[model samples]
Target: MTALIEIHNLSFSYTGAAPHDVFSQVSFSVAPGGVFCLLGPNGTGKSTLLKCVSNVLQGWHGAIRLDGRDISRMKPADVAMGIGYVPQNQNSAFPFLVRDIVVMGRAPHLAVFASPSTRDREIARAAMETVGILSLADRPCTTLSGGEWQLALIARALSQEPQVMILDEPTSHLDLGNQVRILRVVKSLAGTGMGIIMATHVPDHAFIVATEVAIMNRGGLSRKGAPETVITESNMRDAYGIDVKVLHVAGGVERKACFPSL
Candidate 1:
């Protein structure tokens, strides 16, 4: 199958007084129904690369294509129609209802100056239900806990019904249970043939849900392969500069985990 998203020789740098490269020569692809995860330490440009893919940042030296169409030339609305991006959540001062917030995702599908139609509302409702947040529809966004707010953002992106989803640290700052919930949602979404690319600090997350994984550092992605192959002790030490033990438990529902060897 053709890749849903492709990036070749991608490089970016912030232009300012003390300019420096965030990452260079990064290449990857996400196939339909694939979960691609980027693992790295803080400030390693994982988030920057995601922004470039989403077209939120520009002037990079590389090519990004969605279904063989160059994203640089696509209109912003077209990008939104193809890729749903969920950036790190921020609190909004205005207390919009959750349903209204999710309905905003329909903007890309509606004509200019047009309001959301009944079908759009129905789609938004389905999106909410998919993320298990339909009960929060009437609640104000400001009243949500961190986990609830994150689910709302995911619902908003889901309402777009895009082919691919880009999530920047979807599990960040959440408790263990919520993190697992989000990971399960990610896997479930991919099971439905929506490509997912996520940047995360947790190595175990990649092991849990990623069909493919890459460890990114300052220069670029250092390793890319299946999670068990790419997220080993050596790569973890090289990427994070800390010793970690990658463990496999053979009990009920076997799984892999990472622990710092402090």
Candidate 2:
């Protein structure tokens, strides 16, 4: 299968008091219809890498190609059209209607000063239905719960109709049921040939839905392979500095970590 997005020898650094580098010579690719997970501890640069792939960060020292073309050469609008980004826990301070928020995804296709056409509304409604939140379309975004807000954000992303979807901690603020629902929606979308790259702190998400796993540590990709190959106990320890016991589950491995004795 051809890769929908490719990263080759990518490197990025942030300006700080001490000038810290977040990534160094990172390389990976996401194939069409593939579900890839980025796993690591806090401050491991997972979100930075996702932003680079989505073209939100610029002047990186390597290549990011989309459909075999250089992403740097693509305009921001074009990039937004090709890649849909669902950020983590977007708190809308103002009360925007849910339908208005979803319709913002169509900005790439909209003419300036023109209202969304009937087709746009149809697409937005369809995307909302896909995320199982069509009933909340008219509600205020701020009035929704965390899970409802997440579903609405995803609905907005789906409304973009991109070839690849990049989610940064999609299930971060949700409870177990909401987490399952979000992951189920993401899995179902991947089944329909949408390439997905999601940064997740939860190992269970990768165990259940990810076709491939990339473990990041110390500003680089330490392991990349199928879930079985990459998410072992030793790898977990290495990446997270935790001693974990790996259990063989019905379909995948369950990870249990041991804390240091006092």
Instruction: Judging by lDDT against the true structure, name the best candidate.
Output: 1
For candidate 2, write residues 123-240 as lDDT tens digits. 9999999999999998988899989988998988888899899999999979999999999999999999999999998876888889899998988998999987888888888887
* Stretches > 4 Å off in candidate 1: 16-20
Clashing pairs in 1: none
TM-score of 1: 0.96
Deviating ranges (above 4 Å) for candidate 2:
16-20, 250-262
* lDDT of candidate 1 over 55-153, digit per residue (tens): 888888789999999998898889999999988965989999999999999989988989999999999999999999999999999999989988999
What overall lDDT, based on C-alpha atoms, would model 1 receive against the true structure? 0.91
What C-alpha lDDT, on a 0 to 100 scale, does residue 204 get in candidate 1? 85
